[model samples]
Target chain A: MAKIELRGVVKRFGENTVCDGIDLDVSEGEMVCLIGSSGAGKSTLLRCINLLEPIEDGAIFLDGQDISVPGLDPQAVRARIGMVFQSFNLFPHKSALENALLAPRRVRGQSRADILPEVEALFARFGLADRMHNYPDQLSGGQQQRVAIVRALAMRPEVMLFDEITSALDPQLVGEVLDVLLTLKSEGITMVMATHEMGFAREAADKVCFLKDGRIIEEGPAAKLFDHPQHAETQAFLARALK
Target chain B: MPHQQTAGPTRRQIFEARQRRKSLVIASASTITVVVALIVLVPLAPGWSKVQQSFFNGAVLAKSFPKLLDAFMINVMIFAWSAPAIAVLGLLIALARDAKSPALFPLRIFGAAFTDIFRGVPVILTVYLIGFGIPGLGLPRPWNSPYIWGSLALVLTYSAYVAEIFRSGIDSVHKSQRAAALSLGLSERQVMQDVVLPQAVRNVVPAQMNMLIALQKDVSLLSFIGPVEIFRQAGVFKSLMANFTPYVGAAIIFLIVTIPATRYADYLMARQMRERS
Candidate 1:
């Protein structure tokens, strides 16, 4: 079974349908990128998959289970899926290492003795080995996002969703965050990212999806989709992004 | 070492200039006239001693000190019972008012009306109405007098102001933070309790402390109910001795409670300001 499947998912706010029947499948250990212009429902589609935004009409499957049904325990589902936000959303009062270890300690009821080794390894891997005791405000934007990734990864999620993780960084600082994401890529973590960095999307993703007007107009192998976009919208988006 | 000369005003010079200005202004004005008037009036009116003796005599304060202490203790008891209630109620009302549910609209309105009526009416009158007047309705022994009545009035009045402070603090939390919490798979209740409330309470610490200080003095209004509390005890002493010393002593006692509350508020404000900078 695929790790995640969104079948004809529809989400709306008031009369505005942000996602009009989004269909996507992410297999085990595959890196998928959903790219689109602003207000095109790329983030909404990602949110629906993570159950962050509820789908008004359609089904979302996680490990062959119907998760989109109302009254489902999304917490149990969320434990299997971790999300990293654009703003980094690190708990301001907690230290970087504590932020990473919070959910495992809290939601999963893992003892500090059990979670500390994983926290240390994630911090060292993200080059924040010395910043364990620092608060979110004490770190730079890029450092904070790295900690956020480490925090989600500490939960040991089966599918990770990155929503423009580097979009909030300084121009010169974007590379450091992208470097961390690239490292996560090498770890063979199954990931679905909504991003604007076309170069990374082309290089890192196994499958590239072009979202426009709340629908996937084109999707294929990353190289084929980036090189030969069939839809006019996909071609236009790539042209603008490349230029 | 290189010698560096500073052009800015030295700290000692600034301090001396302020001191000189204060003394010069004091000397140029009415202290001399007030002193002269006091000298002339002492002999012209023999009863002046009665007023002075009454006003300055600490003997009443010394004798009734235990009674005064009991009254002060009662005031502290009132605060202990009422402060926690108001804090918890105010936070709940704040959360209720902000919730998207349609039912919260009525609760929000009720909270607003509750605050407005209590805030607009004098605390002294509220105690009288609840303690003395409400009994006329044959409403039960609860309304028979002011002990419970007075405390209830105080709680109702302060809870309204505290509710507003809580509201402002909750409002201070960024909307994006709520969205983020929701995205993190926390329920509405969990988000409010774990994230929003903590941030809101931290934001309003000084304002809430200010209200707590105000509550310290507001308890004095309970004396109107004829409770044997400090102010009431002081009033009885004032009538018997025909002096103001007991009243002045009661004022000093209130200062003792309020001064610490004020210092705490200032510390919280300074800390918050420093964090922002």
Candidate 2:
């Protein structure tokens, strides 16, 4: 069974359908990238899978259990599927270490003493150990974005969602954040990201799905999709994107 | 030899130096003109001596100082007790006003109404109503004490204003911060307590301090309800001495207490602005 399954997921904002009848599957340990122009509902689809945006219709399944059944606790679903945003929304008041420790300590009911070693390891692994005590404002945009990713990882989520996480970063700094995703992929963590980074998606993604106007136009293995997009819309999008 | 380098002011440097010197001259000229005007106008005014004697008599000021200080202690005590109470009350009301749950609609309305009524009514009237009206009920000893009632009245009125300030601060936090917190599996209440409130409190520190300074001055209104605070004591001395010096003395004491607080608030505001930029 796929790690996550979205069947006929439809998300609407009033008259606008942001994710219309989306169907997709992310296999365990696979890295899937969603590529599309702005307002094509890439972000909304990822959010719906995490239950951050409730789908108006259809079901989302995690490891064979349907999670999109209106009454299921979204907080519980969110804990299982962590998300990092485009704008590195690190808590400005908290130090980087504290931001990483917050969810594990509070939601997981782990003591600071119990979680410290693990959190420290994450920071050290991410090359942020030296800057752990620095507040969000003290860090550069790339460093802050890395900390945000570390914060999501601290939840020990089954699947991670990245919503244009590097879009707000400077061109030079985007590499460092993309490098963290590569490291995560090597660890065999499942990831689904919405991105405008065509090169990174082509190089790193196991599969790439092209979306346009709230629908998936084409999807294939990353190499196949990037090398020869089957659909006209995907071809046009890549033409504009690669340009 | 290299081309001769003249170390004295270059042409551009000379022009800049001339501009600086001209600004200095203008500054000093303005300062001296203001001082000369004050010097020439003050002693030439009518009733100057009578005004001085009645308002600035050294002997009367000295005699009134100790008594006024003692009375001012009451104002300090009221402020000390009520400021924290007002803060807690205001925060609760602000949270209620900002609550999104359907069940909390009534509480939201109540919070809105409380702020509306208290902010619209003159604080003096609230003091009069609570301070005297509560005593008129012939309640227990604690309820009848003017200190208790006066402080209660002050807290009630000020919490309304402070709650609005807090609400604005809470609203100013970017929506993305809330999304980030919620996406981390924090419940709504935890999101507010851990994420939203801390940022809101930090954002409004200067505004809150300004309210505190205003609260410090508003304690004087308690004098109208017979609490014998600084202003009331000053009034009594004015009646007894048939001179206005006691009132002036009270004004000076207020300035002595509030000016430092005002300056500290200004400094904090400046620091906050600098940090944001």
Top lDDT prediction, candidate number: 2
- Using DockQ, give the best candidate's number: 2
What DockQ was computed for model 2?
Answer: 0.82
Candidate 2 lDDT tens digits, A84-182:
999999999999999989899888889999999998999999999999999998999999999999999999998999999999999999999999999
Task: Please provide, for model 1 over B163-234, each residue's C-alpha lDDT reduced to its tens digit, 9 standing for 90 to 100.
Answer: 888888888888766665555555677667766787888899998899999898888788877677888888
lDDT scores in order? 0.84, 0.93
Weakest lDDT window of 10 consecutive positions for candidate 1 chain B: B178-187
lDDT of 1 at A191: 93
List TM-scores of chain B, every candidate.
0.79, 0.93
Calculate candidate 2's fnat.
0.77
Predict model 2's lDDT versus the native: 0.93
